[model samples]
Target: MYKLYVRPGACSKAINVLLRDLDQKVEVIDARNLEGFKSISPTGAVPAMIDEQGNVFVEGVAIILHLLEKHNSAMLPKELLKKTDFIRWLTFANATMHPAYSRLFFLNSVVKDEAEKANTMKAAAAKVSEYWQIVEDKLNKQRYMGGDQINIVDVWLAVYAGWNAYFPVEVTIGPKAKAMIADVQAMPSFKAATESEKF
Candidate 1:
C-alpha cells in the first residue's frame, strides 16, 4: 500500500488529486499529527509519500513524475521540446511560484511586527505577480503547459492558482487559464481532493 503524508492546504493536496485520478490507493497522514509526520518525513517537510516497499518520496515534482510516468499517462508528454518545456515549467512552479507564497503566508512566524509582515507580504506579492503573468502568457498560447491536453504541469499550475485567493496577492488569469483551471477542477478526483482543503 502507498502511504501519503501531507499538511492540509499544502502542495501535497495536488498529489493526492493526481493519485485519485490514477486510481491508486493511499493512506494519508494528517498534518495535525506532528509525531507521525516527523517520523515519516525526516526533513519535516510536507507531501512525503512512502511506497509499499517503504521507499519515501519527497517533493511534489518528483511525486508527480513518478506516478504520472508509472501510469504511462501522456501528462508527461513525449515530444522532445514539449518534454523539455514540461520540466522547465514544473521547476518554475516549484522553485519560483510556490516559495513566494510560503514566505508571504508565513511572514508572521519570522517577523514580529505587524507592519513588517505586511510589507514583506507586499514585496512577495510583486514577485508572485511576475510568476503568475508568466503562466498566464503560457496558458494564453497553449491549451495546457505543453500541448492542448491536460498534463501534470497543468495540475501543478491549477493547484497553485487555486490557492491564490488565500494570499494578499492579486493574481489575474487570462481566459485560457481560467478555462484550464475549470477543466482541471471539473475532474472528479481533483474536486474530491481539493474542494475540502483550506489553503
Candidate 2:
C-alpha cells in the first residue's frame, strides 16, 4: 500500500485522486494532523508518498508520474509522440496553471492594503483565466488533454479549479473548461478522494 500525505483541498488532492484512479490502495494521512511532516517532505509540503518499497517521493508532478509509470497506467501514453504530449500537458497543468493560481494566494497573504490587494488579485485572476482559456480551446478539439481518456492533468486542473474559492479573485474559467472540470470531478476515484479528504 502507498502512504500519501495530503492537506485537504490542496493540489495533493489530485495525487490522492490519481492513486485511486489507478486502483492502488493508499493510506491517506492528513499532513495538518501529522507530526514531523518535513521528515517525509523536506519542504513540508503535502502530496508526499512513500511507496511500498519504502522510497519517498515528493513534488506533485514527480509523485504522479512515478505512480502512473510504475503501475503502467493507460492514462500515460506509450507512443513516443503521445508520451511527449502527456509530459507537455502535465507541465502545463502543474507549472503553468498551478502557479497562476498560486499567485492569488501569495498576493492575498502579502498585499496588506485592501485596494492594492484587490487590484493585484484581479490581475492575477486575469492571468489564471488566460490559462483556462488555453485549456478551453484545447478541450474544444479533444475530449481531454490526454486525448480520449482522463489523465492526471485533467485531475490536476479539476483540483486547482477548486482553489479559486480560497481567494478573493474573480477567476473566470470558460464554459468548456468548467465542463471538463466537472467531468473530472465526477470520476469515482475523484469522488472518493474528495470524501477521504473531508472536502
Candidate 3:
C-alpha cells in the first residue's frame, strides 16, 4: 500500500482523487502539522508520498506521473508524442499557473511590504490569465488536454481550478474555463475525493 501525506484542498488532493478513481489501496497521512512535514521533507509541502517499499516522493507533478506509470493506469495516453504533450501541460500548470496563483492569494503571508502586495497581485493575476488562456485555447479544441480522453494533465489542472471557488486569484478563462472545471467536478472520481474532504 502507498502512503500519502496531504492537506485538504492542496495539490495533493489530485493524487488522493486519482488513487480512489483507480481503486488503489493507499493510506492518507494528514500533514496539518508543519513541523511533522518539515521533518519529512525540508521544503515542508504537503502531498508527499511513501511507497510500500519505503521510497519517499515529493511534488504533485512528479507524484502524479509516478503513480500513473507505476500502476500502468490508462490515465495517460499511450502515444509517445501525446504523452509528451500531456507531461508538458502538467509541468506548465505546476511551474507557471500554480505559483502565480499562490503568490496572488498569499501575498500578505509571502510578501512583507504592503506597498509591494498590490503590484505582486497584479503581476500574479496577469500571469495566471495568460496561462489559463492557453488552457482555454486547447480545451476549445479538445475535451481534455490529452485530446478526447481525460488524463493526468486534466487531473493536475483541475486540482488548481477547483481553488477558484475559494481562493482570491482572478483567473479569467471566460465561460469556457468555468464549464471545463464544472465538468471535471462532476466526474465520479472528483466528487468522491472532494466530498471526502472536511472542508
Summarize candidate 3's per-residue lDDT along 1-199 as a digit string, tens digits.
8888878888888888888877887787778865667767668887798888899998888888888888888867689987888788888878887887786668746777766776776677777788888988988887777776776567767888766655344667756666667677788888877766664
Runs of candidate 2 exceeding 4 Å displacement: none
List the candidates' TM-scores in order: 0.86, 0.96, 0.87
Give candidate 3 regions above 4 Å deviation: 110-116, 165-169
- Tens-place lDDT per residue, model 2, 6-123, is 9999999999998888889999888995788898898998789998999999998888888888998887788999888889999998899988887888998999999999888998
lDDT of each: 0.77, 0.88, 0.77
Winner by TM-score = 2
Model 1 C-alpha lDDT per residue in residues 1-199, reported as the tens digit of each score? 6787777767888888888878888777676656657777777887889898888898888888898788887777778897787889889888888887677767646777878777887787778777777877887777877777776667777877777777654656667777888898888877777654543
The 10 consecutive residues of candidate 3 with the worst lDDT sum are 162-171
Q: Which pairs clash (backbone N, Cα, C closer than 3 Å) in model 2?
A: none
Tell how far residue 196 is off in model 3, in angstroms.
Answer: 3.0
Worst 10 residues of 1 by lDDT: 190-199
Error of 2 at 177 (Å): 0.9
